[model samples]
Target: MPLSLPERPIILTGDRPTGPLHLGHYVGSLRNRVALQSTHQQFLLLADAQALTDHMHDPAKVSRSILEIATDYLAVGIDPDSTTICLQSHLPALADLTLLYANVVTVARLERNPTIKDEIQARGFGRDIPAGFLCYPVAQAADITAFKATIVPVGEDQAPLIEQTNEIVRRINRQAGADVLPEAQALIPSVGRLPGIDGKAKMSKSQGNTIPLSATEDQIRDAVRRMFTDPLHIRAADPGRIEGNVVFTYLDAFDDDHAVVADLKDRYVSGGLGDSVVKKRLEDVLQAVVAPIRARRAALAHDPGHILEVIRRGTERARAITDTTQRDVRRALGLFTLH
Candidate 1:
């Protein structure tokens, strides 16, 4: 089911333009983001600057993927008319706000962020973690406060980033003797993570287990055909394990026919159905699921200029709010030089 945000709060969420979005993004956020636009003032940031925080050495890759990322957002149901989609770099206010937020936060505090710790371990950036990577939480605080966003939808791994934003919000509000920024709240997803096709931890681009949103029909078919299944269930008569099985995970995510899925589960557990048969069903389900999305994406791909116009208009609206927030922040910091 798509997520719902409470009335009376602004929502801000976005993806870093490090790569094209994939199936995991659909399950995690994009699906709900599409639905939320009708009900709330949603800001979808194409966080190119944030991508550069880690991809400084690969500017070309970052530059190329921003268009791909925006395409993915449009392919899904993110209507630019209802949702404001903007480039992160276009908002110069975010960088200005980040500078002020950094002073309010301590170095020790930044180092202890759980998300940063995990990213550092995964990327093998021991002591050489970029200063930008370490200070990203402050940048994120600027992202939230720049738009006065009160609700931030994030996965569990991103909860620390939201907390960091709220901390700055409280600190800045108190320090200036004015409640200029509202404390941003983290709406953590109830489901923890989506496993990769390899049945490993989270689905990731570096892990080579993602099904790209822009993937062709043949590519999706081949990927699903190669999906991991229950290793212990070697023969048709062997009882299959449902828990931690990739096929069942996909079914839980995509298949709306719970009764049919239950029947398949029973067949597998009762030592009659083979793993091949179950895999075939999973393949069918996945194909049925993504076919319409692929078709819609193809239709939109025919008009690249139209897509860019949507983003251009969205960027303007986004800049309007950010411009006001930057003015207020400068006033608070005495950066404004008005006579």
Candidate 2:
């Protein structure tokens, strides 16, 4: 008889526990996770090991941010009952799978990954890049295949990583002479990317441009006040350009009132709307979104013990799934000898 498949697809997605998640993260994946959890078996990973690929000097920071990322997950309405939040380092199976998958991929392939290249340039690590950081794509493949995840939600820039993962999956199955691992498809977000307050193409913690999900009202207001706008619009009478306007980009992503935002865009271009007016509107929209998240984070903060318990439970559950995958992999590769 053929095997039974799950009614709902399994989804694998996560963030590096290097810092608090930000507005960019919410727009990119968090909102989608909240909506998909009830309909799918979702596995949210706290990728501490991957974070260490770059931040090896500060292991303590990774430890601290595990709870921070989990709280953000819960604050954003990723219910523990519906979503299994797992820590990447706790699953030794993932490490083993990563090693197995790495054998199938060439150094040339890893070097050619666009996401990896962009990261190497951004971090200014020309020749001094860590080998673990360079091979993270394989580790990510392990994370996805271990859960047999059919769908992976990620940003547009990460689409290349998904492609690399599928390549490894195909190579491994062909080598093993069986379809042992499932291939995953990337579910790219509609609002694919969010720019930094400084008008950079991406918001990043290293750039110091992110507005954290747990930010206070004052912090939100301050970030908004400093947001980049058209530099040429010197006065209220001057026509403003919107080609690279970060404020308008943010408004398009966050503000729900389409007609109102459209009107604001028209007024700004035609020469009467001031930057302050647009910034205030963005500030209001962001505060409305983050206020409830902030409140929930505050409440969750009061009970660190509860947060740790949740992580422990999810870690145990994730380990069992990965253990099965590891056994299958070892057997397929003819490495499972009787002890």
Candidate 3:
């Protein structure tokens, strides 16, 4: 039997257990998750199943990161008592809904999705894209609707997935002639996307440019030292451009003192601040931010049993909610259930 949902706005947001979540994940979504868990019913899905879309050959890595990312969440102050942290593979209804949704969205429509196109090109899959990779948006739709998630926190690049989820919701609701699934809204964080230290691309695990949640003090300082700044600003008196400077960008994202960041930016642009000075400030800030999280992650890593227990309990709770939705969706579509 399925459990009943709490009477509140339900939020479903998570990360693929592909790697240790980085500052990008924190700035983009994790911070918001921590805040929303207090006001909304939240579920953090360690997306092991979805991670398999690109990592089918490395299932072990996917399984391993489940614990790593769950620890990341806990270290970042995501209270397991507040947020239900579930493993995606343990939720059978998600796969069932994915199969059902696959029939709703056309292949051409999937090909036309901008997010899907960008990912395929970035991965260099060309014409030989994996079927699972191509159909992940459908899978995401299932994950969202199965929990009846009304709000899905995501980055700007992922807004298309929420739209696609709504399209599926409309399709299913039409078949059922009622609102069986609530469409989810993409709540983009104010910080947007955090770029890598090189300013080449977004901070990503695959790009090897990420500062992990468990990054060491030395690693944090080193990453900040190498952060991209204006090449033209060769000396302390040379005017530096903050337009593409990754340092200011991170400062803006992480540093709480807006006035100080503005002053630094002004000095940088007015030909007085050196890159080292700016980098030093950023390094200190990042060190402070990452030190506590690193310690918490280290402590959590020592207790693998505690991590497993958290995932186990959350998965069980999530199964009930998703199972209830699955049965409702089945009934709405007029599919006969084995009662």
Q: Where does model 2 exceed 4 Å of error?
A: 1-4, 337-339
Instruction: Evaluate residue 28 in candidate 1 and report its C-alpha lDDT on the 0 to 100 scale.
Output: 86
Candidate 3 residue pairs in backbone clash: none
Error of 2 at 251 (Å): 0.8
**Which ten-residue region of model 1 has the weakest summed lDDT?**
1-10
The per-residue C-alpha lDDT of model 3 at residue 244 equals 85
lDDT-wise, the better of 2 and 3 is 2
Give the per-residue lDDT of model 2 (tens digit) for 9-106: 99999999998999999988999999999999999999999999999999999899999999999999999989999899999999999998898989
In candidate 1, stretches whose alpha carbon ends up further than 4 angstroms from where it belongs are: 1-8, 333-335
Q: Pick the candidate with the highest lDDT.
A: 2
How would the candidate models be sorted by TM-score, starting from the highest?
3, 2, 1
RMSD of each: 3.7, 1.4, 2.2
| lDDT head-to-head 1 vs 2, winner | 2
RMSD versus native structure for model 1: 3.7
TM-score of each: 0.94, 0.97, 0.97
